[model samples]
Target: MFRWAIIFAVIALVVSLFGFGGVAGMSKDFAVILLVVAVILAIVGFISRGKV
Candidate 1:
């Protein structure tokens, strides 16, 4: 999931360079959402690891 975020970020950068404003914006939004989700999951995993 985190890797996907990085891929989207790179896609956004490439699309922005090509002048695709809408695509870039969408990709950036996706990247942000994925990054947040990945972080949350990571935190949950770390916290739960001590339980077992």
Candidate 2:
């Protein structure tokens, strides 16, 4: 999931450089969402590991 976020971020950067405003915006949004989810999942995993 974190890798996916990084991929989307790279895509957003490339598209922005090429002046693809809409695509860049969408990709950036996806990256942010994925990154948030990844962080949440990581925290959950850490907590669960502690309990175990």
Compared with the true structure, model 1 gives a TM-score of 0.98
Error of 1 at 9 (Å): 0.1
Q: Report how far residue 21 has shifted in candidate 1, in Å.
A: 0.3
- Quote the positional error of residue 40 for candidate 2 in Å: 0.3
Q: In order, what lDDT does every prediction score?
A: 0.99, 1.00
Give the range of the ten consecutive residues with the poorest summed lDDT in model 2.
Answer: 43-52
| TM-score for each predicted model, relative to the true structure | 0.98, 0.98
Residue-level lDDT tens digits of model 2 in 1-52: 9999999999999999999999999999999999999999999999999998
Q: What is the lDDT of residue 12 in candidate 1?
A: 100
Q: Which ten residues in a row have the lowest lDDT in candidate 1?
A: 43-52
Query: lDDT score, residue 27, model 2?
Result: 100
Candidate 1 Cα outliers beyond 4 Å, as residue runs? none
